[model samples]
Target: MTRRLLASYLSLVLLALLALELPLGYVYARGELNRFTGAVDRDAVMLAELAEEIIDAHSTDMLPGLAADYAHRSGGRVVIVDRKGAVLADSGASAARGRNLSQEPDIASALRDRSATGTRRDAGTGAEEYYATMPAWSGTSVHGALRLSHPLGPVQRRVHEVWLALAIGGACVLAAAALTALALTRWITRPVHALERAAAQLADGRLAPAPVIDDGPPELRRLAATFTRTATRLHHLLQTQRSFASEASHQLKTPLTALRLRLENFEPYLDPRAHDSLDEAIGEVERLDRMIHGLLALARLENSATTPEPVDLDAVVADRAATWAPFAAEQQVHIAVAGQPAGPAVAVPGAVEQIIDNLLANALRAAPPGTSITLARRRTEHAAELHVIDQGHGMSATERERAFDRFWRAPGTHSDGSGLGLPIVRRLARAGGGDVTLQEAPGGGIDAVVRLQPAAPAEDRFHAGRPRAVARFAAHPARAPRTAGATAGARVPGGSDVRT
Candidate 1:
């Protein structure tokens, strides 16, 4: 940016200099040529007067000496011609003094009672030379013509020097402008840079400041102050939200649990026919408790502004599958771990576990006795996927689509689910730069998939210590043949919240 700004400034300066200097140089060259021409014509006329007496008397014996003296003083070639255009004297070639040499245009014009002064290029040397011719008159009868010529090399040299001086001045001006533009660019962009850093830090939940000094532009300084205040307010709002969730989770859970217990205790006092009503009331309270818990989890997940980090997805899957295995077995269902190594993936520090637990809890609820819940780990083009497949009746496209909506549940779902689990899972997954999706599992079940950004692979040495990690869970050879298959979906209630 600084370079671009400086270049723009220098370009304008160069154009201005070119605009002024080019015409001044052309005009100076023309003026110099005119001055040289006029000087030569005057000198030629003065010599022509001196030669008038000598030529009229036909006493041209000392004419060559006079021409030579004037030529030496004026740095030019001189020639004296008689009335008939015959050369009488020559400063350049004394041997050609008697030559008939008036065929030249300037000499002819001079002999015709006219003066000539102009410049012409030398045919042999390609150098420019100026010529001035004057006619000498003895009472209106032309006595002779005096012609003087000089090379324009000296005037051209002066013009070149002037051009060089102008170019140097332009370059110096451009350099100074470049330096000034660079300083100004830095001064103007400093506040912008600070605000950019602060925005990034805020995105990462750091709440850094956008500090600007008074030396910067007024608009930028005000912007920096406004940005700092806005970021502080935003950080405070989010902090308050997370704090409320954390506080509410602890504060509300016990009351809800106690309320459910109190409702159960009223079972004895209620009539036999009212026992169903008492049970229904207790169930609703429990549902409310779970619902509130899930809502708080979602709140924390959303407001924490947690950044994704590298997680050994394979290890996380294996640990979660193992943790849920006993529960599956208690229901006479096997937990089947399958698929290739998913390697490390980018996810929130504890997001992978919460996502797995929520999906597994729902899967266990859906799976039938004697069936299996399959924990499958696989890699897609740019992400790792953990699909919790259960052998229960799968959801329709509509149910799957609406599953992630907060507090949404399938129409015929019979469980006492709070309908907040799928939303929580999705929120956590997205916060980890991933997603949770529900699709039809092979052979009839819901495939609850959690996809995450693939991260740098773990070291081989680390994997070497866990050679039995061929599936989502560490292999148990003694129980390798255990029965396992497809479980629950996106909108099912979770068993517990794992939110650390």
Candidate 2:
């Protein structure tokens, strides 16, 4: 953009220089030609008067000397022609003592009692010359024509010198214009580029203070000021929102705990029918509590601006699998861990664990008895992925699209889930500079996939010797190995393949 701005500015300057200089150069050359020609014409007329005086006095012998002296002083040739179409004297050489003068255009016009001036090339020297002729009259009877001829080479040389000077001046102007354009472009684009970077950081959830740029054009400076204010306001608003969510969750938790305790206290004094109703009430409270926690988690993840660091994916996966194993057993479902984690992956601290926990909770709610859930980690060239595969009634395309929406539940699914799990998982994943996707699992279920940034190679890290634990958990007895063919047709919405 800066280059384009500079180029455009310089182009206009060059055009302006050409427009002004070109016409000025032509006029200067024309003026020089006219001035030289005018001087020659005046000299020719004066010589004609001298020749007339000589002819009237019948002293033709002095005419040659007079013409020769004038020719030497003026740097021109002079010819004295009589009325009878013949040269009487020539300043150049004796060979022109009687050369015909009436046939020449300038001399013909001069014989008609009119002065004439013109320019023509000399055949002998191949150089251009300017001629001026005037008739010498003795009482209206033409005595002879005095013609003056000057070579055009000197005038052309002067014009060339003027044009060269103009060219040099124009070049200097263009150089200054180029420098001015570059400086102006830098001045304008510096703040604009800074604003662009700030905007990008904001979009990436970095709500820090924007850089202050107090220089450049007034409009740009004002724009930068406005941007700084806007970023500050936005950051404040987001921080306030996160604070509200956290405070509200904390505030609600006490009352909810008291309500649950009160309901439990009444359980011992109630009949079976009332006890069943009281249990339903307690379940609703628990659901609300879970929802509050989910909101707090989402807020925390959204507000966090922590940079991602390298984490051992194998350790996280194994730990999460072990934690979820007992819960899977309670649902009469088996948990299977498969696939080796490839090196350390990059993620926000504890982000992978939170993602795994949410996915496992959701899968447990959907999985039926005797179904096996698979926890797998896969690595690609640029990314590492954790996938939770379960055999359950999978969601449709529309449900998959809104799966990450808060409180959104798929149709025909049980109400045990708070629906904030997937949303929180997605928020955490994105906060870690990663993403979460839901796909149809093999054998009619859902695959919750989390993509994280791949860690830099060991040699590229500052502390290359730090050891990473590669946790390998034992597969459960009820776990069944998956076949590749069974997962062939599974695909994430928007055409992303989790298997890859």
Poorly placed runs, candidate 1 (over 4 Å): 1-18, 37-67, 78-149, 208-213, 264-280, 332-340, 369-382, 456-500
**Residue 89 of model 1, lDDT score:** 85
CA lDDT of each prediction against the hidden true structure: 0.75, 0.75
Instruction: List, residue by residue over 1-500, the lDDT tens digit for candidate 1.
Output: 65676677778878888899899988998998788888887888888998998877778988989989987887788889998899988887888877876898988988998988888886557888888889988787888898888899998899899889988987888788778888988888777777788888888778754565576799988888888789878878987887887688778877887888898888888899998788668657756776676666666666666656777878877877777777677678898889999888887666776677777777766778888999899998898999999998878998888878877777876566667777877877887788889999999889998888888655322333322322111000011111233221122222342111
Clashing pairs in 1: 363-488, 372-484, 372-485, 389-486, 390-486, 390-487, 391-486, 391-487
Mark the regions of model 2 whose C-alpha exceeds 4 Å error after superposition: 1-28, 48-64, 79-128, 133-147, 153-239, 246-249, 254-282, 306-353, 369-389, 428-443, 447-500
Question: What number of backbone clashes does candidate 2 have, counting pairs of residues 3 or more apart or in separate chains?
Answer: 0
| Candidate 2 lDDT (Cα, 0 to 1) | 0.75
All candidates' TM-scores? 0.74, 0.64
